[model samples]
Target: MDVPGPERRLAAVLAADMVGFSRLMEADETGTLARLKTHRIELIDPAIAKNRGRIIKTTGDGMLVEFHSIVDAVLCATEVQHRMMRRNSDVSPARWIQFRIGINLGDVIVEGDDIFGDGVNVAARLETLAEPGGICVSSAVRDQLGERLDGVEFEDIGEQIVKNIARPIRVFRVRLQQDARSPPDKMADTVAQIGRKPSIAVLPLVNMSGDQEQEFFADGLTEDVITELSRFHDLLVISRNSSFVYKGKAVKVQEVARELGVDYLLEGSVRKVGDRIRVTVQLIDAESDRHIWAERYDRKLEDVFAIQDEITCAIVATMAGRVEAATHDRAKRKPTDNMAAYECVLAAKVLHHRSAREDNAQALRLLDRALALDPNYAHAHAWKGCVLGQTWVYNWCEDRDATFQQVAAELETALALDDNDSDVHRILAAVNLNREDHDKAAYHQERALALNPNYDLIVVQQGELLTWLGLPEEGIDWIKKAMRLNPYHPERFWNHLGRACYCAEKYAEAAEAFSRITRPDHTHHAFLAATFAQMGSAVAAAAHAAEVVKREPGFTVATYLATQHYKREIDRRRHEAGLLKAGLPA
Candidate 1:
């Protein structure tokens, strides 16, 4: 009786069964089958083929297929539904042929022209979970859809305790509706509805150094200024993750407004050479793409940070004063026009953005230099502390605990000097998040957002914190807002978005988010692999798996765990769980 073996391979399994096939067949077997065959031949098969799907087998009332890409699966599903709706327009409800579809990707056993195992089983179970004439999918499928398909809504159904399964399966119901129409011309109404609080996005400063290496300096400076502005508690600054999306892109202000859902935009450029640096900046009304204010500063290299602070202060004062003057009566505050301390901080920003051990050391040195020039330079101290905290978290420092303590002390000093300094408070919030003080993190983050509603980095950080705190739906909203503000930001923003969706068990969305990153490293590649595995695309999973192994040899759960050092503990855990579920070692 020892005569059994198995065949195995990876594949994506898509199952579509008639919603009321039995009842329809009983009512009219020949008529129902005839219509089903006609629909499959005329619409479903064509749409599937167009989306690059392959039909594997078809039962009398159902069809099982596979797709090379999850995107294709979704597109096919959407097209199938749309075509079916069109075809059924003239038919009565009882006579119309509707379907419930499910899709999953994973490894499976192929036995004599048939598929078996969890991959097939999950797909079948998911199909059962689908609402009649609707689509249901595992988290894996959801991650791949990202923002490509608009107006499609999803509802989380939590973990499904499926029959014959040891672990509970998380599922989501997808709602497909007609595309959303554009909003009516409601400019006046929108302006009136705008609360007294103003919103803004800080676009990544252009690097005019003619050398790509200097990009980090420009980006770092922009991030620092955004962080500083976020402390305002009344301003709605866009988040860094969102604003950074516009890095290295020439975008129209009106388009930026429409995307970021903001009123203002801040753009700038940095030029540096030996012993000297020149910076230019401007604030624009995003709705009209009109420049409201512009400035330029030229100084010796040693005085860069001082100039940066002066410019930051001026920009904040000008923007804040304009809003306050328009809505209320308040005197605007101004900072001393000290060039020396500002220069030190600017130089430190250049070092910090490099994000390497040597560069972080240089940043520290420059911060110390700035402090020597002006002990009351609150922004410089706060930025220094923030950089130190990042260095510790990134494992660039050996004595991380000591470094964190030093950062805390510096942040306290910064706050003592200027309680209203939004940047200082934002750094403190990050510190609290790292310390697992989620409530404090949220409070401080909210305060920062209030001060400068336009600060993008703060928004991203807030979203990250929310995600960690098990408030993924809210986190997703914030992250989407950030992306709207800076559509062209770095790939990392998409990574954060993917992590959020994955945590929320929106697996298809997660996959779509991750796919947007053109080139991913070990962790990101692992995320992609796991997502593919969960979706039942073994081939894609294997490809990403090889990359993950190449990048992180001997990778394990511990290694995966070590990478979950987000500002918030909950976010960290959620991210880890996402990758783990996707089939990463952890």
Candidate 2:
């Protein structure tokens, strides 16, 4: 039996229950009830109401409250708990009334005036885990609050096995003392390292063209807008890796802002009809959940770059109150004037990201078409190198050497055409790293980071280079940062993290990272086997080892080692020993 047409929405669910309701009632029913009523009237109810919380229902001992904002929910809970502690100071410990609170941000099912779902259930379970006069929050609630709630501190209490919840929930305890601050987490540290500039993330634009094929166009437009916005060195624009994760998903701006650690967000849609395209963009102050500026552009498809320029300038002006003369000039530098070529590049990018043999082939064809249309298109040239490199890496091409040469030539041309292009530098860095040209890779990686500090591809490559440079711990951080930046990042990112962890001798962590990939190819299996072997899990090692040989019969430690670019002989030998212990061919 299912309820039809039931309303549902995302909310921060707060569940609170008295610590000793039964015992309190036994002590003095009338006195306890009166004191509870007074507390709610004077402190609890006012705090919830002030923070825009809707009290969905109230039991004799507890209440279920909903808040549109996670921040508000936590704020209300903390306020009530802090006030209760102060109010109970004069009372005997046995007579003091206390409520344990838990908060979770999740999607809830709404029926009449009540909400039902895992969101509410989890909050209730978390409430039971809270201390008598303290607050506990699910990771979702804590992440959504991320360094935003000043004077508040959250200590990660690790994962909790809550009843009725299949998966272990990561819970954080909100310290009753509001002014205490623990050391910032990695994500917070990364945001801080990026400087205190007005940060903004541009979400992928929705494709409203009534054609699924136009999705590439929408994504491309979004990327261009992000690139244009990134050119403003003064504005800390989040990379497409982080922002595009929200593509085709229903998300609240405040949640996105908190997760990305950005104060502002740019989001919109693209609708194309024939030769004309309509683009709608809005800049929002994520903290206030208010629109700062919005505009709709109806223009010929050829004028897409102009639209990007307008959007960039508008955002810069809105955020900084004025656009720098240099930034405004940079915004107008179009990638290419040829519309068909631009569209081809966009389509090719979508195909390239798919990372399949057929898709890579199709991407190459599109890139060729793009290059033919506009020979000087730097992005197209760089992307062609990327596709060719992928083909060579996967042995998709007939001649690996020839493909490698073409990749190098294309990247060189791209570099000559647009020395400032971040993709060009990013690709060059990757290419150099693959060939063991450490110094060249380092140069390009630095340049790429400078050009597009937040680009996920570049960020992850930094980790890759660091791993090869025998700095696996540092590499792991960059890879993880890239993963956070792009929650939907490519599966190969897991491979990168696993490799870094393995190099760092963190076998269990490496195994976990590698296991996150849904479809493990032969290479992934080989790494898993090696990781298991390192951890002395002989049975697990042998199983993954069998998988490796089953997928590639000629798999041998020698061949694999030859392909790997480990700067240190010790690291290289460690991988070799692991593979040997895993029963791979000598």
Candidate 3:
């Protein structure tokens, strides 16, 4: 049954299906079907229209769509997912549904409205490879949109063999991040807006020190430098863990940039001999294959730690001052749901970061979906706990004690499933710190750091905890290190550094650090007031004290003290004296 006069040409095909449709139906078949129908009518259909997608055909739980533009096809898929997230927010996790999307740009034989042949099959196969609530695109789809997706990163998961396909397909997992150092978006107006940030990855230094014993030293040096480089507020630096994935393997810098979503690369080597050390470092523009900066350092190893510090300061001082401007363009914003339990968690993360009561509510709703989608997803459970903890932290919970208990239970589930996930351990660390369980907090913090030392949040949190633990000097150094790791970090980082500085009796330094905050809230003003008071500056202290009360009229030093969880009695007393001296109610 072949039709005559059929046209054949290149087109983009998008294949998508609801993940776990059968299980959802089994749980509540009739309700599930009705909800899915509503979703199709309200969300999916409209998005397809806006993106210029043609409806080809639909299976009971899946669909095949055709698009003239490859970019349209991919955008439609992400738009649909974004819409699904919004719709699912109103429902419970058990009723929430997610889709896995795959896209391929290849030639297809068109007969009437139906398309056939290798291209369609490739997209279908790609769909099966996508993490639920995630999209997978073939190399063809990726190649069609080049620099336009500069801010959008695709994690190359490598080649995969699919059914009914003779050749393996290279798959990339899309992940979204905002980097200020990246070039402007070059794609047409179809992609989402992620921050136009340029990113760089620093690879592990080769231990050219000849002695196998020096390998660890070389590795440590690389990590230290990465930590130092992360301080600039505008630059984006990939974590050391990600950069080290290519350790001992030769990789093209440009290829690495495409995979890591970084525009530049930093590679180096280290060698140490008797009382002497030599280091070589190069900064590369990955896209152009050009060396931006390269230097060799030769120093007598009078003090190993001192030499390392000197090198770190020299490099960070050089790079921190060189941030470039970037702009918005078409960006395929990748999502974050865990690899297996991808959908609900991805939506949850977006909601969680919205910093509002309603957004947190939506986040809880989506996280529930994540757990329903994959109850075995440890991160879902952990994130659920964190959300509950947030309710208490923000004073939104009806019963703080009950919320804390629930947080503990959820973390227990997370630890049981995968204690190795740095986030799980970090959340536990945060919760323990809140409960004043210093031992538990320290234990969890160490575990998290061990899991991913390059994680900026964990690194900064470690400093925060250390400062409270009466090691202000050490905490000051550590937090400063974290700032280098994430140059454009959140404002809270400076607050933590200021707190440590104030606690360590560095009054002027504390005021300077607090002053760096662009938007000072009541807490920032309160900290500044305390620092100024410590330095005996009556006018400056009084001004900040007045601002704090103006911003939070009911705030009192005692109330704030009760909320703080400083580990050392001495530090707490020191802070209280400063605040009280600055006219805060005792």
Q: How does each model score on TM-score?
A: 0.42, 0.47, 0.48
What TM-score does model 3 achieve against the real structure?
0.48
Task: Tell me the deviation in Å of residue 245 in model 2.
Answer: 31
lDDT of 2 at 583: 95
> TM-score of predicted model 1?
0.42
TM-score of 2: 0.47
Best by lDDT: 2
Please rank every candidate by lDDT, starting with the best: 2, 3, 1
Give candidate 1 misplaced runs (Cα > 4 Å). 1-339, 350-362, 486-491, 515-519, 562-583
lDDT of 2 at 516: 91
Backbone clash count, each prediction separately: 58, 0, 19
Q: How would you encode candidate 1's per-residue C-alpha lDDT over 438-494 as one tens digit per residue? A: 777777786677655555566677777777777778989988766654443335678
Candidate 3's residue-wise lDDT over 185-284, tens digit each?
6432212222334577888889887878667767887888777656432357898889889998888888998999987788888888787889888888
Against the hidden true structure, what lDDT does model 1 obtain? 0.73
Better of 2 and 3 by lDDT: 2
CA RMSD per model (angstroms): 24.7, 24.8, 18.7
Q: Mind giving the per-residue lDDT tens digits that candidate 2 earns over 249-269?
A: 999889889999987787888
Lowest summed-lDDT stretch of 10 residues in model 3?
323-332
Choose the strongest candidate by TM-score: 3
